[model samples]
Target: MSDLNKLGLAEARDALRKGDVTSVELTESCLKAIDDADALNAFVHKTPEIALERAKAADARIKEGDAPSMCGLPIGIKDLFCTKGVPSQAASKILEGFKPEYESTVSQQLADAGAVMLGKLNMDEFAMGSSNETSVYGNAVSPWRRGNDDAQLTPGGSSGGSASAVAADLCLAATGTDTGGSIRQPAAFVGITGIKPTYGRCSRWGIVAFASSLDQAGPMTKNVRDAAIMLETMCGHDAKDSTSAELAVPNFEAMLTGDIKGKKIGIPKEYRMDGMPAEIEKLWADGAAMLKDAGAEIVDISLPHTKYALPAYYVIAPAEASSNLARYDGVRYGRRAHLAQGDGITEMYEKTRAEGFGHEVQRRVMIGTYVLSAGFYDAYYNRARRVRTLIKKDFEDVFAAGVDAILTPATPSASFGLGEMTEADPVQMYLNDVFTVTVNLAGLPGVSVPAGLDAQGLPLGLQLIGRPWEEGDLLNTAYALENAAGFVAKPGKWW
Candidate 1:
């Protein structure tokens, strides 16, 4: 079953169900793969013993003729998600020692469906960086390029580890949070399928918040089918998260329509920005052509406020991140800084904060504090919110004009060398999220699927933005494209 490494979760589950394999055996295979792929650092904490035990329990249930929908499936929970006994640090030194007494609603839901928790995975420190390099544990290397040599490409972040793990076959599927493209960007980097669902679709109750309003948890997997199965389990309402909507969670798995014949897909005119790399431009055109070949009606539409999304997202996300992170004061949990005897209460809080937050985290905190400050609130934060409303309106207007969904490039470029972004200015990094951040701001469902690869052989992803609560259309379109644009580039023999 060595070749089983690249098999989709559904395929493996079928194998397990047909007596072709056992949960214990599959779990052991994944465990050995993790051990063999240590350089990927996909996992912050790997618990083989617990994983195997859960697998055995699932196998026993299968034998007893009473297995849950996700029995025997292995998943990687992003470290930002809390686990009962396992640590969840959000990959920051500040929350380094913190462990939640409770599991996140998403994690608990998955466990109830019988998914085996492989372990907590790594992320950007406090989910701040676009690349995984900002993790306090150091960057989680992309397993595809063989550790840190040769290409040494980034796996994307802060869900880089999740994407890399899923792409490299270290895990069947993984959980990811999108504050500002965390889920989609990394999925693009590692050549995997990831969905950033409708904001309230997946309850955010135990996820470590980056930007409360924008932070959403979703699934990252090798293909759309695996993501559909996991989304079925995680998408639901919970009383704990007051922001959680009371709307009924649709049968996401059952709704993945295979036929896209005659559906209208909008090609947003704003996305074809000037100076965009030619290779990416070709990828977008190719994607549109493929959809046209699949009997889709393509029309050029305008999101007039598209250029304003990045600025608006930066302001709003940091503003919300600052408020959400205030709970990290040394009093309850995580790291604490030493203070001098003369240091007063204010100094204590300040010093501990300075010690706890990393450079990117501090940058966000500063931006957040500034915009929300007494004098700047109206000028910065509120104005950005108003602009966000207009952006959302743009999408609604297009959909009202009979567009099934809007398609665009997931990122400006494919996976770059690991340190290429980190060494650049922070604005450059923020620009990376330019294409994907608006979906989260509008509380809409968005997904990135492998469209094609660049000339360098790195993967390129095309994003589909759906109307609020219309993930079904977005996913169906993705499935159609996945079949048409068949570009699957695996890692080579040499690193």
Candidate 2:
């Protein structure tokens, strides 16, 4: 067998069940790897002690012949997910000392299915930035490199840490949430596979709210099958989230097939925006050609409302974020600063929030509040909602025309330098989500798979979008792409 360091969840679990390995042994290997790779900044909290305990419990269950699908597997939990005693800060200072008393429905589900928790992974503060620099902890350097130079490049965000850790095999797979392009973009940069299931497919009860209407947690892994296994375990209905879909979460693992032989795939013409890099455009065309090579019929399709997606997403996500963040007014459960000598409670709140939140975070709050305010709600927020409906209608129309799925580039380009984006105007940063945000607005399933690489040696990713709740189709197509691309999930140096 390959070194335990490189094994994925299924491989380790199968080895353990057959008595060829022990959970303690696998967990120890991971702990050692994390210990050796401190510069990656992938972990916000490393709980080796608890990880060992959980691994032992998994070994006990296996001994009794009651092993679950995830028995003996270690998975990283994004800091955004609430873990009872773990600091789920969402990489924000306002919640610096905050610890949840309960686990998120998604994390709890994963635990119940027998996946061992490695620790909390890093993210952009409250899951905000496209590059991981918004993190209070610091940027997560990609495990990839262009050549011999070790200049740090972004791992992508707000799930950059999760993608970096999984790609490095610090943990088998990590949970991630996508609001705009958080999960998919990072996975693309790290050369891994990640899925953002149809909105409402995964419950959001204990995942920290960023843009609540757009955020949905999913998985990051080395390959498509692992993504399926993680998704099947964590996705289901939860009464705590009223928006959680009551529809059955399919057995995604059982449904992954390379037999998209007669599938009809749509390539949206609207995605061909001017100024997109030549390499990115070529990657998309190559991806379409691969699908055609695999017996899938590719057709040109128009989602005419695509131009409005980014503008509408910005208005709606910010509007919702403003409302969601109002709960952190320094009184209920987050950090609060002392007031000026003669000031009152209101001033204390103002001081605390001003000191605690980062620049981008503050910007979103202001934009959100502005759009939702009475003076501008109709002009900005409501108009965006109407455009959101149009974006949804475009997808519905295409699906009605017998399109099995839609394919597009995951991001406009490969991972830019970490500081390249952070130094940019905030609107320029928001433009990074241009291709991925519309699917979120429509509440459809989407995924990003490694397609190829740009000349800079950064990996390119292709996204697959499925009709509402059709994650099975999304994973199936990703699997086909993974095989067609012949990509290997290898990190440059970390661990």
Candidate 3:
């Protein structure tokens, strides 16, 4: 009927269940959109054959009258998720031509629920970098433009493809992973909704590990309701992953009553950094005002260890990254360097890594190795771990003091141009995660709700951080924020 791909997840699911439309029709619409939107480089690996096949099966399942809320919905899969028989490269060259014979637990769950996979979307190489610039397939451009300017902006990463595709209406929703704001930052930049559930809520069985402790898979969608529905389908305990919480999955969509009365939302004083954009500051205040008007109490709170989150994250993430990435030394899977006749095993390892990893991935791996090395372990890695503990405790103390949720700006500012940050000082790029890393360290749930637009017309989002194991409550709060903000802006389809 009316452009099937334009419908949100819940809308499409209802339509499919009512016999108003079939999953095949919806999947085909998204497939055509993916072909038309290739200039954005969002879908790195298109699987039209599999998508259509799955769509046909989903239609049958829908006819049987036992389909889930996500059943027969077309969605984009982030390249990081291992889809058995499909390329699961993590947008890195080292994993070139590597296809996992096993499906990632989250994707498998989604598939089991009858969600049709349109294709694997692009992302930052190995989920590194703030922008999508590190993707081997190329930069995934934001659909938004700044006031008649043709210059391209970044749909924040490493979930840029998910953001870009969803904003452009290429898919109903998409899967994304957050290590340090990867999902929320991109969703904020593109004016959509993304939520990183409480750590260990979703199993990390087949998703390539960047930082095992911090990395988590979640849903990015057009609205809070859609996000809630998709998140329910994505989260579950898996015996394959030890970190996965052995807790029962809740009906997150059903929990969205939007009545946030008496919810005490905390405003962290430390998030008001020096030189913060007046627009972002005002947006944060506006979001707090919206929540207050919705009957939630706004209270000022302190997270004294907030200043150390970035430094601690850099140290801890890279240190874990160093260990997790060590398995890719050309012996088991993925790309291998052509060895010279006289070259030894050591030479093969060095050559393979040197040839495979991009500059940013290499830099992090080196930093990770350095921190975990003999002399600096205590000075850097161990100390950073202790700071992480302090950061987690800060959130715990606030929540223990009766705070229901915390509010902050999702990104320091709206999306910037693609090549704005240079390699000379990569720290500038790393600074993008300043507002989000604390949630990861604390293993709590957080959501980004597109609240307003910047002066340049780029989308700006407000974040809600919730208590551990309370994603249902968090999604309810985000639903309130989304309803209050009334943000319906969409990027013009220039691609």
Candidate 4:
């Protein structure tokens, strides 16, 4: 209890239960940490008032002996999730100053369980970028920096703020949405744990949409156990979301027995891409060795369509984004463009979008629109959908052949310095998702666990892809890996 801000979510929960610490004290500690870490720009909006009020109420619930486990927990919410009157811009100017009258189902459920919201963390505009640089406010700097270097680093995006905040100890944990490796990639880059649940495992209602089919909400936490606890609180079948699965909620924490004996973990040979760094390759092999030592059977497998995952994801995600973002054309809500005396509605839309969106978001919107156009719909969008089906089948076939989960490198490299990837070629930036897009394309659950560090001392993560709706078993496997890796390294307080 000496440094309340440094406690992990599980530790803080226990402290609150033992009367060793009060919810209000823990909330204040986190608020102080948030204020001190402003240089990182993790929390775009601070909500100390709402957080303290919720903490007091949570204390009352705990005193009544009827509180849930998450009750009295102080947490950070991603800016993408609508939280009553809080600003929920997905880091885009198009939705500047827009606050929903209601809350997203995921946030509402967390509130119902007595989790206090510290504030909305920043993210890529409309969850479009790999680095958090696309945010309208500015980039969320990673707490981790290269040895003896002052250069700013990315915390991987679009969940960059979530990863940064959790890594910097600004909050116990934070909510993050993954479209194409958003949550897992950022978590991996920051040396924390993040899990992207199976698509539709968490409700999408009220959360800003990027890709209707691929977008899913999950937790970025300090460890796999914390992720298991948080994910249970965030998931449920929502009547408002047609895609939300109708299923019984399982206690994911209860299933983390760390006993993967006889479990078959697949090593997709295609993941060994040519020119991948020696560190990443060694880290992946080390991760597999750890799992093998944990009594899990390591099986060499093939995901035949793995090579097409990135292209298919780019096509499908953008296609869905164009359709979803059409509502933001200087319309009913959000920022509107000024009009000239002779200008008409079309001119207003053109000017508004041009000014509202960032370079990355606009690029994606244009690509999406082009593919969905009548002249190229079949050639681009239709073919991408076909490739998507094949990617899903690749996972289905692997699992059908007794593979419990798939293991691979989370990112091609460790966190890179901000501004390193100039616009010289955008494909270089897109390659960050090479290993992660397959999970989103397959609509399967994937978790990134901090495994090792590179020569520069930056953290590297190993990803574990699980069967759909089998997150409990997946957490168990991740727990085993986490224990074996024993990665407790933290970033020096450069921020």
TM-score to true structure, per model: 0.97, 0.98, 0.99, 0.99
The digit string of per-residue lDDT tens for model 2 on 1-495 reads 445868877677778989998888888888888878788899889988889999999999999999777877988999999999888899998998888899899999988877889899989999988888988888877778776656787888889999889888888899999999898999988888889998899999999998878999999988898898889988999999998999887888888777789899999999999998999899999999999999999999999999999899988988888888888878878788876689888887788889888988898899999998889999999999999999999999999999998989998877777787655578888888998999889988899999887776778899999888889877888888888988874656733
**lDDT of model 2 at position 222:** 84
* Candidate 1: tens digits of C-alpha lDDT, residues 4-65: 65667789878877888888877877777777777787888887878988888889888887
Tell me how far the alpha carbon of residue 72 in candidate 2 is from the true structure, in angstroms, after superposition: 1.4
Give stretches of model 1 more than 4 Å off.
146-149, 493-495
Residue pairs with clashing backbones, model 3: none
Over 1-495, each residue of candidate 3 has an lDDT whose tens digit, in order, gives 978999999999989988999999999999999999988999999999999999999999989998888888999999999999999999988999998899999999999999999999989999998899999999999999998999999999999999999999999999999999999999999999999999999999999999999999999999999999999888988999999999999999999999999999999999999999999999999999999999999999999999999999999999999999999899999999999999999999999999999999999999999999999999999999999999999999999999999999999999999998878899999999999999999899999999999998999999999999999999999999999999999998888
Write down the lDDT of every candidate, Cα atoms only. 0.85, 0.88, 0.95, 0.94
| Deviation of model 4 at 159, angstroms | 0.4
In candidate 2, which residue pairs get closer than 3 Å at backbone N, Cα or C atoms, i.e. clash?
none
TM-score of 3: 0.99
Model 4, runs deviating above 4 Å:
none
lDDT of 1 at 5: 55
User: Which candidate number would show the highest lDDT if scored against the true structure?
Assistant: 3
